[model samples]
Target: MKHLLNLLAAIALLVWGTQLVRTGVLRVFGANLRSLLARSMGNRFSAALSGIGVTALVQSSTATALMTSSFVGQGLISLPAALAVMRGADVGTALMAVLFSTDLSWLSPLFIFVGVVMYMARQDTTTGRVGRVFIGLGLILLALRLVVETSEPLLASPVVRTLLGSVSSDLVAELLVGAALAVISYSSLAIVLLIAAMAASHVVPTEVALGLVLGANLGSGLLAILTTLKASVEVRQVTWGNMVFKVLGVALVAPLIGLWLRHAHPRLGDIATSVVLFHLAYNVVISLGFIGMTQWVASLMARLMPPADPASKNPLRPRHLDPSALATPSLAISCAAREALHQADLVEAMLVGMYTVIRTGDLKLSAELRQIDDSVDELYSAIKYYLTKISRSELDEREGRRWTDIIGFTINMEQIGDIIERVLIDIEDKKIKRGFRFSEAGMQEITELHGRLVDNLRLAMSVFLNGDVRDARRLLEEKVRFRDLERSYAAAHLARLSDRTVPSIETSSLHIDLLSELKRINSLLCSMAYPILEPTGTLAPSRLQDAAPARPQS
Candidate 1:
């Protein structure tokens, strides 16, 4: 029972430590990481280097891969460019093996201290949050080192050795153990560290450790496939490309165990060092050899998966609200926020389209705008449902407040959708029935006003995604501008109404309704930015409160 308890303790520590690293180090930097990849994606070589560097620092290729996949989905990066980055990310992830082998475990305590100082004392600064990430990573590494040491004695027991060591000599046996370790970790890098430590202690032979390395590579594809589960067919194809490369690499390399042992580059230092070298070499070889075949692989994936149905690409419903994401509430919140922002952007775009259709009196354009509004409505519904599920979880106070804000924002946008359907579209019906026409000047004013509101909406969405209170405040200021514009424009129309020689009745009536709808749409756009820029539902009270609102606005 005592032994069982110790084993359980080690398992718990392992899981807890991993969660800290993921949420703290990986997630905190996710947006910056995304930006870095986005900015560096002009060429395959640059994209590859950026992918490797970012993944190495973040210590999670899955995160890097997901970000790259999203960029590809957005048409920010070409398919070939994304594939290169994915290839480089595999190599970059091997750095984790080297990190585990280092004597950096001693710095874990210092990391925690610095993290606390940055997180608590300098909460408003990116530098401080970055410090917190280092702290989390340091503590996690320390915990992993301790767990391995505490569990070392298990290797000496006959029952344990027999269970663990029975297959050390068999190639298939070693491969299975390696794959299992990867699944347990969800990181090939972590598994490599484990294998290295075990090999150093002579708990497992060098070849067995090497086989595990191969298996770990294959295991990482699990995450890629899972991420693509809800994505478009192109994303699925990219995922398959990831899988095929890793699987084929493993199949070819694992069978050459004897060759690697005899001819692979020799290493200095201990077995851990040798393991690191082996892991690095493996990834580098795969990347260099596979570079030329990128187009071929992409074509094959396209052939196999094909393109997604146009209808299926309509709106987003988050699968991230799953139990898996809920286990890490912080990560789930980030993903949910991303989805919400996506929905908000769709709403803003639909509004702009509606304004164009109404102003120009274009029937074809009106039909297109209506379709977009419907799509936005679908996305809004999906995001709201996902948030409702998230609200049931045990969130930290700050996260709870954010949930309230996002839910409110979604509801507000849904109302905007209703307004478009009921009110704005009705204007079109009237225009068709009454042969109403807007003056050329009236049309220009409405279009320009719509542009301003759309700009505010886009700015607000950016603030929400980045959590930039200043930008949010700037959006609010623009809302005041919008109000002034609304008042001035309405006054101008009334002056025209008072003239004895005014335009036709149909033109005057059309101008009146268009201005009213424009004002309403602009108001909603301003309201959407309100929560993000001022979480309390009011304008930001001070610059010091840069952190997103801590409570829901009434």
Candidate 2:
């Protein structure tokens, strides 16, 4: 029981260490990796190479798969290219297993000690996070050593020997067990290394370990498919396509495992070396064999899961809030920002239709714009929920601020939508239903204010996307100008009311309300710039400067 506990603890450490490395590398290099994947997807070869490099850095091909699948979902890369990336990711993970299979226990203590000191001292900085990666690697090395050490003693027990010997009785059953371990562990490389450790200890025979290796490879494909279950059809298609590649490779290799084992065992000397070499060679053959067939596999996937009918697609659904990306902070932040932009687009559509609705008193257009606001509300809710799922502690200062900015922008958009809907209701009730219009001067003032409001909305979106200091500063200035114009328009409307212009008198309340609401919308849009400028010291501490204190009793 104690030995089993030791073995389980070591395996848990392995999983934890893999997780720490995956997340730390992602948090540190996510933005760069996103850009790299984007650029590399222009071709199959480069895309696969990029996947290899990414998986090697993160120590988890699952993360690479998510990143690539996201790109395919966005229509940024073709399905074939994404599959190629997956192929490369598999090879990369195999390479990771090979690198770790070698004896490197000597470096474990050094890494853990330096990594601990750096992490404690730097704490929240990038260096601290890099140190975290080091710590994880050390733990992984240490854990692997412990797994072997502890499991070797258990092999001598009669009960343990009986249980272990059963796994070697049927090659097919042994293979399935390997696949299950991979899925359960969430890392084929970890499973492969563990199998290697067992093979070296004579806990499992060399040929039986090869069958398990085939099963482990198959299990990883299943893992990818399961992970992307909630993703979009396009993203899911990428996973399914990759799984097909894995299944085909496994089928071809499962029968040949015995042939290779019989021929290579004499030369390889030990079961551990034979297992790792076979794992590496199998992945290499699969990658080389199928790298050119991605397009054909992509076509098969398309046939299996045809695209949804466009007419049935919901306009209100959030496009960019990918659930898989939530595990990676930088990617999740980008998802929220893009969805916020989507919300802004709907709001812009409402704003553009507002002027025509008011001028022509067109109830049909008014109703349509109001309905569009419903979509806006849905997007806002989706984005807010998505951003909240991100762990703020994992984010650096800049990313934390971006997280806040996206939430703020989405909230403002939701409010602007509500206000626009109200404006439409007021227009439909007060003017269109009552057969009233603004006088020419009153209409002109409203036109100018509406035009400025639309311009500011666009500017606010630009500021949000680019975070340019100058653009942010300009947005703030435009807010003041918009406020002044609303006041000016109100004064002009009153002047016309005093003159008793018939149209102005009939629509006085609606006209004034429109000005007030437009100014409010403008205020919300301008709020985008404050976060950008605050760190630059470009914004005033308060809108009103502190008044000079008068000398005592002056």
Candidate 3:
């Protein structure tokens, strides 16, 4: 029982290590990795290469599939290209299995020691996340070594002997058990490693281990399918196409196991090496053979799952706040950031609508703008609530900062929405209902300021999205220019008032209030730049310049 418990703990350690690597790599390179997949999809071959590269880094093909399919959901990549990427993801997993099966136990303690020092020293930076990846790799190696050592004692028990004996002759039963383990664990890489460890201990024959490897591959495909069931048809097509390749590969390989054992058994040496090699060979054959068939399979998957009805989509529904992503902090951060962008999109529409109301004095436009503000509020609530579910324990230092950034942006957006609603209301009551018209100069000032506000809103969104320091500084400069512009424009209005211009006299209150509100909007939009700037020391802590002591007048 102690040995069994140790074996189980070792298995648990393997899973935990795999998860650490997945989440850490994502926290460090998630956006860049997605960008690589997106840009590489120009051809199936390139896309496949990207899949292999990304999966190798992430250590989980499941993460690769989810990320790739999301692009498909957005129409960023075609289904065939996505299917190709998934094939490469499978090949990538096979390659990692081969690499891990060898003897690298000597590096385990070294990695853990260096990893702990790096992570502790720089917990909030990119270095810390890289250290995290190292730690996970070390744990995985140590756990695999433990599994082999502990599993050996279990072989002496008759109960364990009898359990192995029942499946020793039955390949199909082994296959089913392998698939089930892969699905339950949500990681074929971990399962494949576990199977390799067991085979090294002589708990299973070489042929039986190979069958389990094939089943793990199949379970990986099923995992993608079950994961994206609620996803769009474009995404579902990619998973279905990938599944077809896996199923076909398993069917063809299952029959040849006996022949393979007879001929290849001697060259393979030990049972563990043979199991991993067979696993690699199986994926290599399928990846090479099926790479050309992606287009045809893509067509079949398309027919199997047609595009969803246009009417089924709710325009106000959250596009990027995926519930399942909450398990992974980096993924959840991406989802929340994207949803915040969606919120900004609604806010942008409101900005445009408010301009139309002010320009044409159209009272009807105010109602439509109000409704848009409501949508912005709705999105703000959804994104905030979604982010709240992510556990604090899951976040490292850098991710913690990013989480706050997203929350801050969403809150700013919600306030911007309220301000827009108020601006619309002021327009309706003070200007439109009262039937007042601005002087030509006054109207021109409003138009010019409104145009600049819209442009700065776009700029602020870019700065928020990219975190570019140059752009952040530029945004701050514009805030100063805008404040000056408002002051000058207000003085011009007063000059016209002194001239007793009829239009200025009739619309003085609304024109002055309109300029003030636009300045408020610009300030809110520019606040996003402050977070980007403060770290660089480029922005002063207090804008109030130090008042120099009065020079000695004495």
Candidate 4:
């Protein structure tokens, strides 16, 4: 009972290590990794290579699937290309299994020691995150060693021997056990390593280990499907296609396992080596065989899970907020950031439509535009709720600050939507209903200001997404320029009023209100810059130069 408990504890440690490594690497290089995957999709082969490289670094094919599926969901990559990337991801997992199966016990203590020193010294910096990765690596190695050491004692027990004998000849049962272990562990790599350790200890036969290897592969596919169960149709389709490949590979390879084990087992010299080699060979063959068939698989998956109706009313539902990701704070933050950008896109659409409404004086268009704000409101609510679900305790200082920034950016976006809605109402009630029009000069001023406002909004989004200090600085500069333009436009409108220009005099109140509201919207849009700039110490304490002292009142 004690040995069994130790084994289970070791297995749990392996899973924890895998998760720590994954999340740590993501926190440090998530955006760069994403960009690498996105840019490498120029061709099918390159896309597959990128997938393999990324999955190897992150140590999980499931992470690769999520990233690829997101690109497909955004229409950035085609379904077939995404399917190819997943194929490479499987091979990457197989490679990791083979690599970890080697003897690296000597490095475990070294990694943990160095990792602890670096992490404790600079817990919030990139170096600290990299140290976290090393710590996870050390734990993984140590866990494998513990699994081996603990399983050795089981060999002496008659009950363990009997249990092993029962499954030695039953390939299907062994395969099922392996798949179950993979799902339970949330990592096929860990399961494969565990199987290797067990085979080396003679607790499991070489043939049985191979069967479990196949099961582990199938289990990983199932894991991806289950992980993305609540994702969008496009994402589900990607995982489903990958799952079909695994099922087919397993079915075809199950019958030939006996023959290959008999012929190849002796030459490999040891059971662990034979098992790892078999696992690698299986993935390589499957990758090569199915590399060209991604298009067909993609089409079949699309048929199985058809795209959602384009006119569906619930378009505001959160697409990127995978509940599974909430366990990894960095990943959860990324999802929130992406959804916030989606909110910004909706706001941009409304802003563009407002200009058209102003020019055409179309009350019907204004009414339609007002309905669009409902979608914006729904998205804002969804993002806020999703962000609140992230556990604050799990977040480090940098991640905590990022969380705050995302909240502030989204709040500003929601406020901009409300301001635009108000402006539309004002146009409908004050300007359109009274059939009042600004003079030609006044109309030109509004158009120019609106164009600049739209441009500034886009820049603000770029700053939010990239956090480029230069762009943030430039955004602040534009804010000043915008304020000056607003003042100048107001002065010009007043001068026109002083000249008693009939059209300007008639629409004076509406013109002034419109300019002021636009200026307010620009202020909200540029607010995205402050969070980015303050972190880098590039933002000033005040936006004003020193002013003269106030004189006493008379």
Model 1 superposed RMSD (Cα): 8.0
Tens digits of per-residue lDDT, candidate 3, 134-160, equal 999999999999999999988889998
TM-score of 4: 0.80
lDDT of each: 0.68, 0.87, 0.86, 0.86
Candidate 4 — which residues are off by over 4 angstroms? 27-52, 76-78, 153-172, 205-207, 306-342, 355-360, 383-406, 431-452, 458-515, 532-538, 543-554
Top lDDT hit: 2
* Model 3 alpha-carbon drift over 4 Å, by segment: 23-43, 117-131, 156-173, 205-208, 266-269, 308-342, 382-406, 430-445, 465-471, 484-513, 543-554
* lDDT (C-alpha) at residue 177 in model 2: 95
**How well is each residue in 1-554 modelled by candidate 1, as lDDT tens digits?**
46547655654555455455655554356556767888887777788899799877767676666666656555567777778888889888886667667878778888887878877886545555576566657656765676567556766778867876678777777767777766676666666766776677666778877877777777777766775686666556666787788877777666676776776625354777877777887788778788667788888887888786667753544432333333334545666777777677767767777776675667777676667667667767776766665533335446766787677676767777767665556766777556676656566777788788778778766766675777767776786788788778877777766663234345666566666776676676666566664545565566685777689789
Worst 10 residues of 2 by lDDT: 537-546
- Candidate 2 residue runs with Cα over 4 Å from true position: 309-312, 548-554
RMSD of candidates 1 onward, in order? 8.0, 2.2, 4.5, 4.8
Flag the better candidate by TM-score, 1 or 2: 2
Arrange candidates by lDDT, descending.
2, 3, 4, 1
Model 1 off-target regions past 4 Å?
A: 1-8, 11-19, 26-29, 116-120, 123-128, 262-269, 309-374, 385-409, 420-554
Which of 2 and 3 is ahead in TM-score?
2
The C-alpha local distance difference test score for the whole of candidate 2 amounts to 0.87
Alpha-carbon lDDT of model 3: 0.86
TM value for model 3: 0.83
